[model samples]
Structures are given as structure tokens and as C-alpha cells.
Target: MQKVASKRWKLAEKIPPEIEQALSYYPAFFRQVLYNRGITSTEQAMAFLSPGEDFHDPMMLLNMAGVVERLLYAIDHHEPIAVYGDYDVDGVSATALLVETIQLLGGNVTAYIPNRFEEGYGLNIEALGHLREQGIRLVLTVDCGIRSLQEAEHARQIGLDLIISDHHHPLDEIPPANFVICPKQNGDEYPEKNLAGVGVAYKIAQALLRQRRKELPREGFGLDLVALGTVADVVPLTGENRLLVRAGLKELRRGGRTGLRSLAQAARLNLGALSTSDIGFGLAPRLNAAGRLESALASYQLLLERDIQQIGMLVQHLDDQNRERQKITTEMQKRAEELIQEEGFEEILFAFDESFNPGVVGLVAGKLTESYYRPAVVGHINGEYVRASCRSIPAFHITQALDACADLMVHHGGHALAAGFTIHRDRLAELKQRLAKIAFEQLGDLDLRPVLRADVEIPLGELHPEFLKYLYLLEPTGMDNPEVFFVSRNVRTSNARAIGADGKHLKFLVTDGWITYDAVAFRQGHWMEAGLPKEVDILYRFEMNTFNGRESLQLNVVDIKPAGGD
Candidate 1:
């Protein structure tokens, strides 16, 4: 690891007086973090700390006018409309939100979530032909169809009207849909650009809500679905997104939706105090497991169903599926690592096997990318074609790299960080060479070491119960506004020992000259080389760890470096 020089924290010069005043309400160390993140003005800080739905204007999104107009026309004519969506949490939730919104608007609508194993992602031409045969006059796609140029043409050829509401990064050419509500579309002026797929669907719902002049249902109508999609899609939780998720989580905890309540019950989570972490780590993976292991339609049906017993049954099945997914993912990860070791890939790693499940390749690729901090691609040889998923670090854009090899791909689309594609089985080796060339060119002369961003630095003496209490104001942290990580130098370890049953976790008591604090380093067994240091520089986040009816402030250790001479 490269060593960074120690320097005193300097607040940004452009910090406004109001922000300084707000800093008076916080510790000086935290104030430094606010300044570093460009939250130097009181207005900016307040907005960042407390976001609301008012931050976004639905009208600002491109194609909103056209989408709303066409939807209203469909409602007026009572056209038979199909809500076509992908199978993941975002796709399912987007489909549920839009179907509910349109149904409330008196539109004849039915939802169709593509089967992961049979139909795959986005609009399949055969599915569109089937919908046409079913006499579906209009189709609205959510969370997909941004790059379905040929599929859209097929729909047009079959006399089916199509509207697309997607948030994926678009290619140079857009499909000829009646209206496209993708924020990435050309000339889109929406201020917030990084909306998840479900976020785009929520915007459409917002537009319809405004047009109808109806108050959002106070009984927790759409927020559950919103929360599911926002968390699962891993969109930045800032601005409008933060507001939606905050409100949605509130509704989720209040027990507004049967599906959410059942899911929480099945997962053994406390519905009364649900947090973003719970949603991301606990619920999302379970919901996504169905799509990955079996049928994403199970998740979609669970969210939309009104029957309580049915919801419970589906939750049980999802829980089981999630356990299975964990097993499969673990095995795939081991195999992927072995492949990398055997291949000795220095800068980029590419692995494929006929035995690899197409559904889990994306997850395996993500794990490999994080493990090595390199551009990683995992694919499954599916008969004549190879379905692949690609994940990249912050320094690389995987989708753009895939686009460069567009001629070699049958279909592909995704964001800069993650993407997926398909190629003829015979072309796998050539595609791997092409991808490695692109990665080498783009990553040349760039440092590939992982960065753990510390929000602030403080003496261990400053960590107190009162200070940890004040930190609660920064709850529900994820994506853009992450949990605050503080670095403390020259901290002496009073005691350290393995804590967990399998010795996977490490517990320690650390102290400065004036004060002592409890700390826990999860999954740090491998890092416990030699004896624990008496004094170390610790990077950690303050969290409330509860166990055995005890609630106390704890340092969640991120990284530890040997302390220099005091």
C-alpha cells in the first residue's frame, strides 16, 4: 500500500459564514468534513442534511410531457396496456408503482415482468410479438427498454404503441418509442442525473399525481415499492432520492404495506425501526435472489399481491431462495478466484465457464472486481451464446468499454460502473482480448490502490456517548452521503481479542491519553498478524452496536495503520 503524508486538515476557503455557524453546532472535526464535501454554505448543508420531495420538479424530466399525455389518452380510450418490466427489485418495484398509479387513474393495465431464465433483460422481440398477439394496444416499459432499438422496431411493425421509462445509460441511438422518460436521453434537463431505474418510474408516478391533483395516498401506497427499488438499484441517496427513500422507509416502518410487513417478519427484522442498512443488506438481497436464482416474477407478484397469506408464502419462498443464492454466490466466487489465480491476470481478469449460472455471473463479477480492484468480467457459456456481466472500479467505465466492442456483442447496455452483454460463444476469446486492451489503455499510468475515504480526524479522547448521540442526525447513510469515518492517530490499544464464534471478528478497547472507547473490527482475523499494536492510527465509523439488551457507542473499524512516533 502507498503511504499518504500526514497533514493538518484544512477547511475549504469558500466555506460560507452560515456553514461556519452550523459547524458551531457540531465538532470542529465534523465541520472539516462538511467543508471537504462542498457543504460549506448553511443552505447547502441544510439541504444536504434534510432533503425533501420539493427538490425535484417532475416536469423537468425529458419526455414527461409526452409520457403523461400519451398515458392520459390511453386512460381516456381505456386502451389495454401492458406494463413490461425487468425482473430485478428495481424492475419489479417500478412495474408495481406504475401499474398501481395507472390503475388508480382508471387505466386498463396489467404488469409483465420478464422471466430471467427464459426472456432475459429488457424487451425481447418475441415477447413483444406475444403481447401483440394478446391484443395489447399499448405497452409501457419500466427499468428497461432504453437500448431496445430492434425490439421497439418490432413492436412498431406489429402496430403496438410503446412508451419507455428507463434510467439506464443510453446508447448513441435511441429506440423509436412514442415517448422515452429516461433522464439520460438527449436534451434531458433534470437536475438530478443518477436516479435508479425505480426512481425514473417514481417520477412518472409523481407527474401523474400532479396531473390528477390528488394527494399521495397516506396509507403508504407507493413508498414501499419506491424504497425497494431505490435501495436495490444502488442509486446515490442524495437530493430527491434521499427524500423518496426517507419517506418510503418511514412508511415501511409504520406497517403500511402487507408485503413489506410480511417480508420484514420473514427476515426477522424490526419493522418499527427499519433503517437504510436493513433495506440494502437484509431485504434487497432476498428480493433480488428470486430474480437471480429462479423467477423475478415471484418478487413482483409478492409486492403487488393483496392477499396476506399469499404474501407470507412468497416471503418464505424468497427467504429460501436467498439462502440458496448465498450458497451459489459463495461457490461461484471461490471458483472465480481460483480461475484468476490460475490465469495470473495482472491488471484485468476475465473468466468464463459453461457451468457458471448466467444469473449469478454479475454478482460473482462484482465480488471479483472488489477483491482485486480491477476490471472483471464473468460469463456463462449458454449453448450458442455467452451471456456475460462486467464490473469496473471507479477508474474505469465498463459500459463504454462494452460499447467500444459493440460490433462483437449481440446486445449490451449499462452504466459506467457496471454493465452486461452477450456474444456468440465462438467470440469469447476475442472479446476478452478486446476488453483487456481497452482496460489496459484506459488504466495506463493510473494508481489502482483502493481508497478508504475518511470523513474527519479526531483524537480518541473526543469520542463520547454524547458525541455519538449527536451523530444520529446523520442517519440512513448510503451512496452519496455515506456514514462518517473518522481517523484517530496514536491510539493505544488497551486490549484486543477475537470475539465471534468462528474468530471472524475482532474486539478491542482503545484509548487516548484522556479517554477510552470500545471498538470492533469485523472480518479482521486475516489482518491480525503479529500482536495487536499498543498504538495505531485507526479509521472507523461511530455506530450504536446493540447486543444482549445493551446499547453502547462503538467504533466500527475500517482500517488500521501502525502509529508513527508520538
Candidate 2:
């Protein structure tokens, strides 16, 4: 029901006639899309479309040889190894993969996921002591431990061999783990640096499996966990990450993983028709709920569990927890908006709640950043120290910004747009001032307006059943590699109806003289009150809709404006 205003619709460059003639396999609109995405050549297009035969070599990763050697020795000797992981979905999937892969190779391993509320993120001294008490001779961390410089040293002093495999941005000082296997630390020309925790774990799995056998077992064996982590982490869905998801989706559709099958059933998802969106929207959140509300070990166990009744119970718990997570986030968002207003709407927003769930702080920050188009810092107001989640727009690198003020924080790690840290409550104001100054220096002069980039401007008639098939070629779309967008002009709306609870969405029948199409606009129910103008220009994604076993084309309208507006 909320209509966005002041959005900038940027159209893709027009393709020349000669180029279009040569790219007959590509629809004219999609040709521009490929070009915009840096796929200007036929070979580039071919490679993007068909990622076949090869993936990046695991040995090419930094310290991979060391990781493999250390891990192989642990496996052969049957040393008790603790798989340390964070609490998010990326960490959950990576933990599951590492545990299963180690078990498959006849290794002694146990999963150790820190509680979000208790242990917080990454390695802690208390956990190390407990692991040592449990006779953990070696610690293999997935998706975390990159920034645990102190804890890594403590593990060494306590006579535990530590191997860290994480994908987060490294601080200036790397942890003293036995071998840190992250590509970014190499400073070499690796093909892809955007592998999520699970992707990194998958590479380790591939190397271990190939080391143990002559030929690889299967094309995409056990990739469902990899895909779930890759997609859920919101990593760039290009390069090697694309290959992983593309293969993983096939495995997911096969219904081979009992836990995933039970989860899909609980979420009312059809594995046969599973897409990346299903994983992102339905499955990932539930998997993430285990970490956000409770121990991530629950989700980790769900991934490896084969018993039907246990899986059913886990799925039910995850579903319920996900619902509770949603409710908590909604209330937090409301409080965050109020905090924004109280702060007088500064350049960088700071929001905190004494009662806010520390786990959903990132979600709140993400929502606030998207809603206001500014960097948001959402903190869980602990008594003296606070755990804060920061989300930023494309213009600012949040982790880099955190690096600028690293001296003030207990610890921090993340990527460009999202990061987290712990700081004392007393320094909150100074932290705000420091970050605000940096944001002003970097982004104050910019437009700060949200822009929707379109692949091409095409008539509504161009979208047909055939076009959906072409769109199928671009699967597993997410961050970095986005879904296609179209700018359709002179669209006439025949009728408009407000749908959803309390009329929060707009359903319309639109035509551009040549084609009449069904359209759905999310959060635009306000348009129905004005009866929708006779003519308009709409920015939308051409979507294939299915209902009652029938397929048809519909426009998923993103933004609408007057027909002649700039």
C-alpha cells in the first residue's frame, strides 16, 4: 500500500542494429542486458550461459595445501575435531557440509555453533576452554574465526590445532590459525573472491573427494547445502558462485536430501519447481531462524538428519521460529522508524532497542537501509556493551568504514554492504559521529536517490511464452547478478483492483496497444484510490505466472509514473 516516490529509472544502453543482427539467439532486449552485465561478446555470453566442464581449482585458494594436509592428517589419525561455525545461514550450511564431508571421509568431527544470544559471533575464549575440556584436539572453523586473533592464539597455547575457513573480509591482522583458507587473503588474481562460507566449504569438499578417488563421484553431489548457503548469504551470484548454485538447484529439485524435502513440505514448496527465490524467501529464512532465535545446531542437525519423524519435528520448529522471527522483526522495524524520527533523520541512521533481539539486528538494519536509502546501524542494547548490525547502500563499503574506526570496537567482520561489531554503549554517540563524518565525506554530495536500472525499453507485447523460456537461461539470479528489468512506455491500464490484506497491492490489466497483460504491483495499493491514470509508464520485470496449472505472462511492476515523466 506504500508507493515509492522520487525513484530514478535508468534505462540500459541501446544496442546497435548490427550487434542485434549478430545476436539472433538473444532477444533484442536481452542483448542490451548482457552488454550491461559485461557480456558484450559471443564467447562471454556463451560462458555465462553455460558454465560447464570446469570450476575453480581448490588448490588455487590461499593456504589450501596446508588446510588439506592438516585436515587429512586429522581424519587419518581420528583426532577429535570441532567444527566451529557462526549462527547465520551461511555458517549453518557450511557447518553442515563440513561435518557431513568429514564424516563421509571417516573423520571424528562434531558441529559447534555458538548461540547468538550467549556466544555472539566468531571465536570466544569461553568456547575454546569448553572445547578443550571436551578433548577437542583440532578446531576446524567454517564461516567464522577469521578475526579471532586472540582466540586463535589461545587455541594454540592450549595445544589445539586450528584451521579457519571463512569468507568474510579480513582485518589488517589475520588470526594465528594453523591455515586460513580464504581467497581474499592471497592478494593474488583468483577468478572469484565472492565465495560464501558454504562455497569455500564446497571447494574443500571437492578437493578432499578428488584426493580420495580417481573420478569425482557425481556432477553435483551434496550441492544442496552449498546452494542454500550461497544463495542465503546474498553473495554475488556470478563466476564460480553461479556454477555452484546452478548445479545445486538441480540437486535440490531431485528431492534427495531428506531434511530439505521435509523443509520444502513444511514451507509448502514444490521441490520439482524450486527456484533461487524459493530458497531465498522460504527456506533460507527458516534455516536462519534456528540461529536467530536459538542455537544454529538445530538447523545444522536438520541438514544432516535422515529420519522422517525427526525432520518433520525440526521443520515444524523452524517454521514456528521463523514466524516468531518475523513478528519480532516487524516490531523492531517500527521502533527503528521511531528512532529515526527522534534522531531528526541524520545522514547515517542509528537505531537501537534495549529489547531488540540481537539476532534480528541485521535484519532491522537491512530493512531500515532499504527503506531510507541510507546506512543503518541497529544495535541490541546490552547493559554496557552492544552488538550492532550495520547495513549500507551501494555507495559505501561498510566493513571498510568499520575498519577506519577499528580501535573502538571489540570485534568486527563482514563484506561491503553489511557488517557487524561490538562496542560499549557509552561510545555509541562517538561511533555515530565518526561514522556519520565518514559517510558525509564519502556520500554526502551524491544524489542519494534509489535508482532502478533497466536492461532495455521494450513494448509489453515482446513478453510472451517464448520469452519466458529465454529468461530461463538466466537462473539463480540474486545479488550482483540481478533479474532483468524492462521500461515499458505508454501503457494503458484498463482496470485496477487493490488486493491483499487491507488492500496493500495493486492488480491491473495493462496494454500498450499491441498487447494486453496482467500486472501485479507490490506495495502500490495507494494507486487504486486514485483509480490509476489512463496512461502510464511502468518499470517492471516480465514474470511468468502459474495458477491452477496454467501458465501466463504478467508484469511484476516495480515502479510506475506518468507516461511522459523523465
Candidate 3:
């Protein structure tokens, strides 16, 4: 069995006296939590906790006017448009949103998602040629094509109008599309720079809706899709994104879309009281499983399906695929670790095998990074080329490292912590060496242990049911905005035992001398092997768990250690 590594606990710094006083209207605990999120004044705290409905003007996005004008012209002229998209959730959601938006506006549009195994990611010349042959006069790309210089040129040569609306990091030489919408591009001043691809598509939808208010529905049209994609992409939930998600969650809980409503039921989720965590762990995985295993068109169709029977079939298919995906991921992670142990760990971990599924390699890379606390690259070596996905820690920028070795790669583009690339199998060794050099230069002296951060340190006795109200304010928390975690020391433990079917989870009772509370530690059943400690320190989230319609307060322990043991 693999030994559980010790984690470093880092308590958050206390708020400044002045800022704390500024936010004195709230309770001290709430004030501290707000201050931890960089909220200094009363106004910022209110806005952070309860975001407003007003969004940044969609017209602010660069080339928005041109793209809108061209799209409107296409709508007016009845030009056939193709919504070209990638296979992931972000891309699929963006594609669905844009396609639905255009279709609702009396435009003729169809979705064209690239196959993961056949066409790979992003825009491709063959797809553009096919679209042109099918008489698609205008092509609108979502979640991809920001770096498709060659594909954009091919579209121009084929006499197809192309508008690229993506949120990925763009290359120096932008794609020569008819119009481009990316906030990160030079001279673009859209305030929310960290939008997911679906967020970008939502902005375009907003722009179009502003022009055609007569056709607008009573409630927002695509906010549910926006929420699904935004949370799934794992972007920072701050600024405009937080506002979008807050509104989107409200929209999602309304259960307006039949497919989503059925999906929630199929996943055993309460659609009426959906939370961001529900979307991240429950909905996103099932939606993404379709693309990871087969084609993503099923997910897209499910999102737009209105028939109850069709929705049920699709949801059941996705659930089965997700289960299969989970099993494959476990096997792949075990193999990756074995390969790494045989060759020894390095600054950057690389595992490539022909047996690795192209769809699930990214998930394996993420798992490796979490287990070893280093940048990891997992790939599938096919006939002549290899496709790989990467995940990294904060200390090293994986995408920038890929950029430094751009000459060896056929294509690569992503954010700082996640990326993917394609390379010739012959040059794989050289690419690995170069990336290792870059990783060492950036991370040579850093201690690489995983650090678990807590918002505040308090005794277990201080937790109360009423405090849950304040915690609710931090709803839709993810990425940069995290949930509140508390560290309790020297808490007495009793009634400890392994609880899941596989005995992988721990259930116990914790007490701070006078007060006792039920606690559940997920994936920490290893501690039961040596008998439970009499007393231990725990870092956990205080939450209310509802089981069989009974609500009870519980500590969702994230990590635990023997008291005073380093």
C-alpha cells in the first residue's frame, strides 16, 4: 500500500485591524472570512457576498461590433452557419449556447463538434473544408480557434466567413478570422479576463440579445449552460464570473430545461436547490464522460433535448460512461505511478503509452500532479504522433514551458496550470528533456509538499448550526474563491470505523472536551488500519449533512494527524 504523505498546514493571515474595523457591521468570523478573500471595505464585502445582476457590457469585448454585425447579416440573409466546437464540456456548452442563440434569432445554424480521436482539439483545415463543401457560408467557433492561424487561412481561402470567439491564451500572431473575440488579446479591455469559453459565448449571446429584445424570453436563456461550463472549466470564481455563476445557479435551480432536469434526477441531485459543488462533482463529470469515452454530441443533444424519454436514455448512457471512465482512470493512474517509480521522479513527470486512452489522459495527468505535487504529462503514443495533456502546480507555468519548446510541438495552447500538445513521436525525448530543464530552472529550490490552507483556526466547540447561514454567503465558491476551512487541534476521537463499501471512508465522533460532533473523513480510512488515535488535529469544513431527509451538523474532515505529531 502507498503511504499517505504528511501535508503542511498553513493558516491564513489575520485581517488588518483597520480592515476588520471597516467590516465590523458583520460578525467577527464572517469579517475574517471576507477579509481572507481580499474584501477590505463594507461595500466590497456586500458586493462579494451578494453580487448584482448588471454585467459588463458585451460591446466591450474586442471586435464585438464587427462580429455582431456579421452575425446579424448572416441571420438576415439566411446564410448557413456552423458552430464549430471542441469535445469537452466547455466547448460543447459553448457550442450549444451559440447554436441555440442563433437558431432562436431565426438563423440557420448547426453544431459541428470535432471527434477527439479523429480530428483532435481546436480548428482543423479538414473540418473547415468540409464545412465549406456543405455550403456553410459563415462559421462561428466557440472554445477553440484562438491559435488556429493555418486553419483560419484555410477558411479564408475556401471563401468561408469565420468568427473566432474563444477564451484561451492566444499566440502572438492571431488567427486571421473575419473577427476575433478574446479578452486576453492585446488591446482588448473586457474586465473579466478569466472567462471560460462558455462565458465568452454567453457574452456574444448577450450582445445578440441586446439587439433583438423583442424576441427575448422572460428569464435568461443560456445562464444555466454558462454556470455548467464555467464551474466545470475550473476558472477563478471572481468578478464577473462570480456574478454570472450566482445568476446561473439561480437559473439552474429553476429547472427550465428538460434535459438538465432529467440529468439532475438521474444523478440523484436536487435540482431545486442545486449548488456549485453539485455541478462540479455531479453534473460536470457525467456531461464530460460522453466526450471522454465516445462522442460529445450526445451531451450536446441531451442539453437541448425536450422529450422526457430521450433525456432519460441520454442521462442513463452518460451515467454508465462516467462509471466506466472512473474505472479506467483508476487503472491509468496506477500504471502511471508504476512507470514513474521505475524511472524515478523528476521535476516534470512524463508517462506515455500506446494503451493510454486519448480521452482520459488529461484526467490521469491531473491525478499524477495531485499525488506527487509536480507538473505531470500523460500522453497516448499513436502511429506517428503523440498527444499529451499536462497539469501543473502554482510554482511552475506548464503552458509557458510548452511555449518555450514550441518548435518541437505541432500545436499547444492552454492556461498557466493546464495545457495539451501534439508532437512527433521521434521528438518526444527531446521535448521531455527541454521541459525538465525549464521546470528545474523554475522549481529547483522549492519544497514540493502539498499545503492545506485553512481560513481560520478555531476549536471544535465554537461551531454552531446558526453559523451555517454565514457560510451560505460563500456559495458558488471555487478556484480562487475557496470554501471556509477550520483547523481544530487536540480534539478527542471516538467511535471511529471505516464506512464505505470498499472501507475507504472514515466515520467518527470528535469532541473538544465538552462538545461533541459527528465527523466524516473521505478517503482517510487508512487511519483505521493502525487503530484510531485517542486525539488528533483535523482540518475540516463544518457543514450540515442531510441523510434520508434528516439534517445533522457534521465536520467534513479534509485531513487529520496525530496530535502534536509532525
* Local accuracy by lDDT, each model: 0.82, 0.86, 0.91
Residue 19 in candidate 2 has what lDDT? 68
Give the top-scoring candidate (TM-score).
3
Q: Considering only N, C-alpha and C atoms within 3 Å, which residue pairs clash in candidate 2?
A: none
Off by over 4 Å in 2: 1-4, 16-18, 21-25, 187-189, 214-219
Model 3, position 382: C-alpha lDDT score: 99
Identify the runs in model 3 with alpha carbons over 4 angstroms from their true place.
Answer: 1-4
lDDT of 2 by residue, 354-380 (tens): 988998999999998888888889999
Top lDDT prediction, candidate number? 3
Candidate 3 lDDT over residue span 45-141, tens digit each: 8887778788999999999999999999999899999999889889999999999899889999999999898989989999999999999999999
User: Scored by Cα lDDT, where does model 1 land?
Assistant: 0.82
* Candidate 2: 10-residue stretch with minimal lDDT: 213-222
Query: TM-score ranking from best to worst?
Result: 3, 2, 1
RMSD of each: 3.3, 2.0, 1.3
**What lDDT tens digits, residue by residue, belong to model 1 across residues 1-566?**
11123322321344456776776766666576677666766677667666655648888998898888889889889999999998888898999999989988889998988777787789999999898888789999999999999998888899999998899988788999888888888899998888888888888888887898877667556877888788888788777777778878888888877887888878777888888888887888888999898888788888878898898889999999999998999899888887777666566788888889888999999988876778889988889998888888878989988888999989998887788998998888788788878887888677666677777667787766666654655655678767777888998897788877668788888888788779999877554555778889888888887765577778999777678632
